[model samples]
Target: MHAGLNEVTLPAQGWMPTLQSALREATRQQHHRLDHHPLLARLVRPGLQMADYGRALQALYAINAPSERCIADYIAAQGYAFDYAAHQRMPDLLADLAYLSLPVPPLAWAGPRLDSPGELVGCLYVLAGSTLGGRVIFRQLQSVLPVTASAGARFFAGHGEQTMGMWQNFWAFAATICSPAELPAARQSAAALFERILTLLESQSC
Candidate 1:
């Protein structure tokens, strides 16, 4: 399997055992408050199959790169600066721990490739949801921990009232992409992504 991607073998029933196991651990370790969030509870069921979620992710994958570029551009255009030292240090720390580096494929951020605001928000939610569990672990690490002084790190912070409205728009956009039947699938996709993120985080921590 390719590192940083889902090339690993899954079950015949399409249940991602590795993903499921990781999430179960993550839930126990970090997202203790997630059970209190109604949205999250509905999204992550214990017996949910991984293939169902993979389908939903496949549906959205085409739009993901452009959406991420949009968010990165938006952050840059807002006059915010990234902490290059922290960014550079993080990969180095991970490398020291023998973790494979994350892929950094070239991203295009200009022209008609730009995503709409709502799409951008939805994408952020997906990204956040996927990585938040792992971030909790990173936040606990003293050496590589994130601080508010870091520019890009602030993106991990939850939205406040003013900025939260934008997230509402994102939620609306996400809603349009799924139906009642597909909601389960979407949740599964989200869980799978989260699990993969946790694996990366764990590798980095080690």
Candidate 2:
């Protein structure tokens, strides 16, 4: 879409438009519930703040950054494997996040074989959806970041239909639990958590 930047290409179909539609629909569906849900409100505030951290992450990884290369090299050296398609998804997702102007939290690169991908996925879903403003941000990141077709970047690209489905389920669960009565409290809590997440991300900067 924007000129140049051959390393990353925008989809011919304009993924951002689709992504925006999804976000708008999701937000419309959830706003009423979220406004009333005390916990949900508390969660959203911090989630918004987390967008800043997400941006920081993008800056760290934007092509030509030494730190970004360092991370890729480290992952390779560590022999961390990843699915190619999944890794490719990362740039688009990051791009979507950038488009939305959402805060980009720093990433926590746990090694390839964590005890449980399911558990980690669940946590990521909650943090991204409730704490960081849901799938829109994730999808955006996939769209923008120029992930290489290599083993090291596979972690970002590999989440297939299954992962998206699971994330949707998590959103449903969050919707069920959030209430307007608890929004005030939840907003405060979310702010605190957002700060914590940012602090954690900044620490990872090389």
Candidate 3:
């Protein structure tokens, strides 16, 4: 599960494309590692086991619960009009855990820093982009696991039909708010978040 262990490099400076595009290009390697993370990749496997799915859920909860709080608090304190609460995954994770009769684990020891707008946007980019992937995973899980949007798979089901729309909205907002000077931090934070999740998955048995 050493998915995101490598160092990150910032994209070269020049005439900028979209913020989301720049971040994606900067973090492509880390993103690929996270996509192939064993705990997550197994969800779509034909032999996917309930125990593995449960462990993945718990691991996700550990990272997402604290990360959501950190993002929410930052948005509120800074008066950022990002509508941060609307994108929360903690409740869905909790629901899925309860449906599976699994205990809610403690938060990760730490969360990614949201100290600046660039940093916060980077964190949001990683989190928001995941909802898009969740939709795909949710569909895959349907054939392998006894779960649904309202049951043990709510976390992956994400924003349901609005997942794509919400993702677009996030990037649009990010483009407007994330300035060029802040891009380095944004890129670093996004890459760091992927690494943090990989580290947590490896270290935590839940």
Task: Name the candidate that leads on TM-score.
Answer: 3
lDDT-sorted candidate list, best first:
3, 2, 1
TM-score of 2: 0.31
Candidate 1 residue-wise lDDT, 83-199, digit = tens: 112221222222322222223323223212222433332234555443433243224322333233133233223232323444333343344332344434444444444344344
Error of 3 at 108 (Å): 1.9
Each candidate's lDDT (Cα)? 0.34, 0.36, 0.80
Candidate 1, superposed: residue stretches over 4 Å from native:
1-30, 33-125, 128-153, 157-161
Runs with alpha carbons beyond 4 Å of true place in candidate 3: 1-17
Better of 2 and 3 by TM-score: 3
Off by over 4 Å in 2: 1-126, 130-150
Candidates in order, TM-scores: namely 0.34, 0.31, 0.89
RMSD from true fold, candidate 2: 16.4
Q: Please give the ranking of all candidate structures by TM-score, highest first, separated by commas.
A: 3, 1, 2
Error of 2 at 168 (Å): 2.0
> C-alpha displacement of 201 in model 2, angstroms?
2.5
Best by lDDT: 3
Model 3 residue 126 CA deviation (Å) reads 0.7
Which pairs in model 1 have colliding backbones? 53-189
lDDT of 2 at 94: 55
Better of 2 and 3 by lDDT: 3
